[model samples]
Target: MEGFPEKGIKMGNMTIKDIAKKCGVGVSTVSRAMNNHPDINPKTKELIMKTIEEFNYVPNNSARNLKRIQSKAIAVLVKGIGNTFFSDIVSGLERECQKKNYSCILQHVEEQEDELDIALHIIKEKKLQGLIFLGGSFSHPKEKMEQLEVPYVLSTIRTAGENCEQYAAVSVDDFKESYKMTEYLLQLGHERIAILTAPKEDESIGKLRLMGYAQALKDKKIPVQEELIGYMDAKKDRYSFQTGYKLTKELLKKTDFTALYATSDTLAIGACRALKEAGISVPDECSVAGFDGMEAGEFYIPSITTIRQPVEKIAKATAELLFDMIKGKEVPRQLVFEGELLERESTAFSSCHESVK
Candidate 1:
């Protein structure tokens, strides 16, 4: 194996990747060896540790050493406060923190606020051991992330390309789940399906879900209609019931469709109310579907058809991962959970198809 510099010499520029390269092992293997994961050969682990010691390299500035301050506190930064879909996930995270005997701080972040900036300030103010970002568009420059001294996890947050691998994340594949919903509607013989989604410039989950909807239509030989796509007003909208109702009302003016798909269950409920006021019967006159299997959707007048995300499971995994990262036991990785498509009373076979029958 290629050896690094002599002991007692500080290699300021050395990194974990560099050490892995010298050992001729994969980055994950190097991580496992450093963390004593028990799966690696004892001889290999010793060699890796020796190499690390020789270069005087520190992984993320010595995880255990940073825990010396003894602050058993963590913070959860939640964006889009009014969205009910995040409630369970937040609750689960808090419970996990409690089980670990750590204090959990929940902070709401506004639409325009920078979560990272807030986190940096809070980390200093509260002396947090670690943190988790609950919901937001997390697309920050590496330099900005490097400023975060403690380990953190992204829970139900959407990150841009290449940037995802740089940190640990727990979320569903938005594009795939959206495509599944769209395809379900399509399979029910619904054409000209309308979609209420994020703003036109959204680059996070909104963009992915929108792309999925479009792809499903194209595959079914249906051309995507511009008027059928409802874009939320990001500056003024909070992904709340009012936003969905307002968007649906506006959509009602310009076009007609057999089915309407909302990106969230909260939006789906609002859309149903708008359709009801407009003298439209859900799943009879028109079909409706939504994402996020929130509790309100189940108890609504017409139970909403949605994509059920495993929030509790996701929360447990996120806590485990963040704590593991803090203890120098794991590396940053993306964990995608599958979303189940729940067919409920809100959506049915398109009436247009029934007319032909």
Candidate 2:
């Protein structure tokens, strides 16, 4: 019920406190209203929002985040919002950040979003001390990499080109891990193994994983069937459960295989769902394997077989690497960890060994 601002002040100069003063409310009330908190009265929030709208008040994140020149905060930019595999990594990052007296901001980049562009904008706006890139295929040219001026670490993703030597990274050897999983499937006598993975053009982890799968097949004297490869749709969420489901359904229609290996645990679960709807028995009829070692895979209906990477260790290491680089304590480097393959309910020895191609 208070009066509005005078016509003289610049739009950007109006603060949340100014809005609160005009609304006869506290700054916290204005903040909760702006963010749509559940506990606020509908009418009060509506009034606050309308008052904010009338003034064209936009929060200046840069000013709010920076204490002086730095924010004391780090960002974890995850490429896909739907990937559950990144959840634990996020938690680990948050914990490590808190232990180091830094704030953590989690950001999600939609499927096919340009991560570097978004990251550059976020770093400027938030005055972030460093960045921890959680997912997405990073094969940026040096020009693009150089644009990200702040210290950053790539976790659980792959990067290529000579410019990668300039950044910090922590992850498993996707190529080696994939080879191990595929060889396990092959040892189970699965000659016609189908791989659900990233598109061929992907030059990151997806490419490495696919390479490992191909190498395992060649070593076993099994020709890599071109038709059996399941590539992710560019328009859909990559490394996602639904992507896995849809791709598996399409693969079933076009090819015949005794076993399936999904590049992620979420994808593996999706593949299992598709196989279930098709009335195909898991392990008994078709062995399935997954990567990422997410806990969800462990509790699923049949319990998934997967190559488990130490999520906490990798995440903490990623944080440590980024912080060290930011503090000028270390040079940018790639940290590789070993992955363990777990044999579980989702995979079994091929039932049709005699019928195998």
Candidate 3:
């Protein structure tokens, strides 16, 4: 009766007994009403349900399952599988799980795979206590989420087309952060800036960042040039160095710009390689910037400028939030972290439109 209130269970934590008193019925009658017992009056059951909803009485459904002794475990579902940035996050989650004495199961969800369907299957087959979803554009409906009964956390994801009540999330605000990076580039006097980003079809982080980039240019009265934007090749990895390198190489042949910004550090590094090959000195002939402050950026010949997301903190917080929800002590919520803009060697001040000279 922990959830039950005192003084006929009316004032504090609500119990079935309180509900029964409010309905002017016996405890068995209230139980019957809640359970949809055939013996209960239909109108009486409907009244009880309304009261339950009004009072927000949630029954502990896990009590029965908790009795079954199973090794505690949680699942981490990664979309885009092997992306290096996610590797750090996944490793962090694994370590956190170890500290909590819980097992971590990682499932790499393919770009085309239906993640929710896969998650439902895993939850039942593995009997996981909780779940952590990494990467991917989330588009599941409330129904789809209900199917995933266990509490789950979405890390580094931008969810669309659904109510957020179904899950908790940990990530930087993609739009504002992207805008910050773009504005930084603008402030450097780079007028004709080009962006190497994800495809037109991406509805996730890529889309948000792209919009932010566009907004930054607009605020500065610079018309967003379609030719300056390089949408990722459908055939290439969206966040890969190869994609960045190829796009920059392609851009060099077609347009002129003083600055180039890639959505990820890996892509930015690739851009640097392409620039070096073309005899264009970084921050001298062409400035560059990237998102995600990966360690590789720090060591690159011309250390890359980037927005550093707090990966370790986000990862640990993700696990803690999910575990708290699993224990019925917390509710689903979104937590956005601030990113640090590190102006490194790869970018420099340039007053004139250098073009691809």
Candidate 4:
């Protein structure tokens, strides 16, 4: 057999022709061996492998992906990776993908409108087998995805004004969970409860959670006070600890609410800080609660009371649904998961009656 070149050149510059020459085999034989072709003899494949190692040959992703036809790789596109909620969803999706001997590719759009177009372009050009939209709103033309015949699922969040019946989704019953949490607060004798949320139309979560809050208060024979409700722009800034802090401060100034329910955990944490700094004790002077049971909530100075969504379960169910769709099996179009209320130090019965005395 021929010998490999000296180990001076970069591996990226190494090509199949170089490997074929060094192995004393045809380019086709080297190609077959690299791709694990059945026609190649074991001994010859073994010889090619040795030469490939010596030369440090690296396969070209673009060319190899084209020849494979089916990548056996799924793309998971989300709004942000830093969010704990999305991270749990990804962990769940990864578990199912690994079981089926498939790979998962994560992509984040950061809520930019143009990124959706780029994602659609990549799907069509790459011929990806499947796509999982984890979060964020995808408003691009659906005709492209439909024409490519690619199976796609929306997880954690659903597309508004789209025919959801035509696709599959895994999401929590936000409206129900929000309503339940509000009802719990009201049951504790909090008629002046405040709702802190982002804009309604931009995110379905905001709209649903706010509706639940309103419904619960109305059902309890309590008047819905406009001043007690807070709204912020969901797309204005990244959902961070600071956003929660600022919004909470504003809400506290706008209303004298005896209880506050933030739509997200981050917001709730911020609200807690603002309340403390303002000389108001949580669950005593004013009760506080939030959605999304983030890990940080457990260690918070006074652990936060919040709602917990089964993020892992949702991810696993989404992956299973996608797998079924790939195998031509008809699965349910929509799967709704329930939320659990985590009771902690941040919330308690209203102190309004005691203050009156």
Best by lDDT: 1
Q: Estimate each model's TM-score.
A: 0.79, 0.79, 0.77, 0.76
The lDDT of each candidate is 0.88, 0.88, 0.85, 0.77
lDDT of 3 at 50: 86
What's the best-to-worst order under lDDT?
1, 2, 3, 4
Global lDDT for candidate 2? 0.88
Off by over 4 Å in 1: 1-70, 355-357
Residue-pair clash count for candidate 2: 0
Using lDDT as the yardstick, the better of models 3 and 4 is 3
**Ten-residue segment with the worst summed lDDT in candidate 1?**
61-70
lDDT of 2 by residue, 1-357 (tens): 234547555566678888888888999999899777897989999999988878888876666665733658889999876888888889988999998878899998887788888999999999898898878888888888888888989998867546666678899999999999999998888889999988777888898999999999999888988899999876665888888899999999998889999999999999999999999999789989999998999999899999999999998899999988888998889999999999999998898775553
Model 4 per-residue lDDT at 138: 44
After superposition on all C-alphas, the RMSD of every candidate to the true structure, in Å, is 13.0, 10.1, 13.2, 5.9
lDDT of 3 by residue, 1-357 (tens): 444443434444567777877788888887787767899889989888888877777654345456432438899999866568999999999999998868899998887787898899999888898999887767777777887888898898866445754568898988899999999998888889999988776766888899999999999999999999989854456687888899999999998888999999999999999999999999898999999999999999899999999999999899999889988999989889999999999998764844522
Model 4 / residue 112 / CA error / Å:
3.3
lDDT of 4 by residue, 94-115 (tens): 9899988677888777654544
| Regions more than 4 Å wrong, model 2 | 1-69, 354-357
